[model samples]
Target: MATPMLTSPLTPRLTRRQLMRSALAGSTAFAVMPRPGAQGLTGPAYEVSAWTGPVSGFALVDTTGKTWRPADLRGRAVLLNFWASWCEPCRAEMPTLQQVADLYGPDKLLVLAINFKEPAARAIQFAKTTGVTMPVLLDVDGRAARQWGVKVFPTTLTIDSRGRPRQRVQGEVDWTSSAADKLITGLIQA
Candidate 1:
């Protein structure tokens, strides 16, 4: 008679410790991946695919308690940024974002910083502390962040006159760099 073959369990199970270790390993690996399109920045780089349609729209109240809509920004180049006060990288990138806003002027380019999942008071404080002069929209519920797929802070989406995302910058970016300026300028001309 042939020996009976011992079969393993149908489902493989992981111990709690093993699961934790695996999760940590996966996160570490993601963190170590090189940020390819960072240009001069020192962080993970991600390629921004061209935006196709209107994408998703979000409503955020400004400091003045007025609602701001994405449609209001049509027919103009816009920098749609998702940030938070607790994020160090977001804080670090604000000055450069401000510089970019200054470079383009409000008429030609609109820099809209949407504070993700933060209270209006906190967002206002952050803007005041950072000296960020651009319009800071409060996404109190993080609706816009989720819509924009913002998994990381300091994510910037550059929208053209037609409300399409032309470029996306993830992580921290030197917004005042010539490369950055050139990219924005090219978007404006497009």
Candidate 2:
């Protein structure tokens, strides 16, 4: 009975006003500046933090029933996002995440939008309605969320080509911004 990624226990719905407030407040907060030696890099929404180490023993299953493992993505960078439909910040970041996925394409990067504990139909419908073209993976029982230690509504991990996490952005982000683009480009090429 692990709880889903910040959408909570999957019950007790939040009102629209509450969602909006949460979105506005959080979207304006967080995001660390680059480190001392990182040079002219920029990340307006993603935190510039220490590496969280290699994320192994994790495999997220996609909508098509295909299991995506680290080995399968060894040569390409990965942006693993944990999100839920009920969370407004997560919803707000959808378009930018989609742009990142589409911009890099599968050969160079893998942007996974993992929905936590939400019904597959609801997740599918949300994506369809929201125009999020990223691959939607379901964490129906919340196990993946727990395993990943993702307690936030939309925490994104930028993993480099060797399956190591380079950055952990603990909130929603404008993944389409030029700063985000540069950060991701550096990860993929480094």
Candidate 3:
């Protein structure tokens, strides 16, 4: 007969034994992972491609024509989103990201939207129409995207406080969801 396991209060579905097993096995926890073509999801099921490498440093200009460097944002958690103007899902998720930015201010978390090969005027117009106030960085030649292994549009990567790439979502996600809130909160605190 199989032995019963004790569940952990942190996640009722994950048992204490299972948690320990995952810890020992080096498992990436996905809290509410959606399958491909999952209805109600903003876009396709987000691919949980966990990249534990350090993000490359780069300099980019925001819509306001202010230059920013990745090296300057090392001490705080950063949510780097790769997006394009033509991507519908990317536009759809901007409001959610704005909400997240508002909730977790720049002090705790920095939400940066990197425009993929798009002109500053179009990106600025889109952001203005969509009511997304987060700073939008212009990736003129896809250099940063290539270095970050970003093959998909609307891909989101979070860098920890120490400037280490932590988690990644390969599609549009409901960033304002409570589950995401908890995840972001934990990442920031970590």
Candidate 4:
């Protein structure tokens, strides 16, 4: 008897332009900023760029088994932080994110820590251990990250109250800093 083979599910193929764009997005994920005075901002060790690609909507369940969707969060600015427990930068910046979440309150700003390809248990445990109180959504299959074009760890996408993507910040920065305040303030005021 011959051995049987298993086939995987069919998925859409990417075009040449899409491939190149993914390559470019990954390559330039980390944009270095010039020293303080040049940009007139000080001590923000991260890059901010306009959001690209389409992120019309997403539905992901959090550790508490609550399904969160963009539609449910209308009339509020959202900070979607793509992260994993293993990433050092992600871990380092989480506390500040928590503080920002606390300061802003859910009515105005909703900070969601979307755990990339991590189990719900791990995400919950990490949140408990780190004292991070924000909602931690699980992206177990990594489809959300790919959909959002987040090729880098610790990438943050800011969505305005009107549900438009405003900016994508790659890398870590002290979220409690003045620069971060300005950024978040703008989003809240939007």
Best model per TM-score: 4
Residue 158 C-alpha lDDT in model 4: 92
lDDT by residue for model 4 over 1-190, one digit each (tens)? 5333222255223334333433444544445442324533334445678885465667899999999876777898889999999988799899999999999898899999999998788999999999999999999999999998888778899988877788898777788988888888888888
TM-scores of the models, in the given order?
A: 0.73, 0.73, 0.76, 0.78
Candidate 2 structure quality by residue, lDDT tens digits, 150-187: 66668777788766678767656798776788879877
lDDT of 3 by residue, 1-190 (tens): 5446454455334334334433432334553333223332222235455677556567899999888886768788888999998987687788899999998889889999999998889999988988889899999999988888777778888887877778877666788877677668767887
Q: Put the candidates in lDDT order, highest first.
A: 4, 3, 2, 1
User: Candidate 1: which stretches are off by over 4 Å?
Assistant: 1-48, 53-56
Per-residue lDDT of model 1, residues 26-71, tens digit only? 3321222232233422333323444443455667788877788876
Can you tell me which runs of candidate 3 are displaced by over 4 Å?
Answer: 1-44
RMSD each, Å: 11.7, 10.5, 10.1, 12.5
In candidate 4, stretches whose alpha carbon ends up further than 4 angstroms from where it belongs are 1-42
Query: How much lDDT does candidate 1 score?
Result: 0.69
lDDT of 3 at 136: 94
Give per-candidate clash totals: 2, 0, 0, 0
* lDDT for 140 (candidate 4): 95
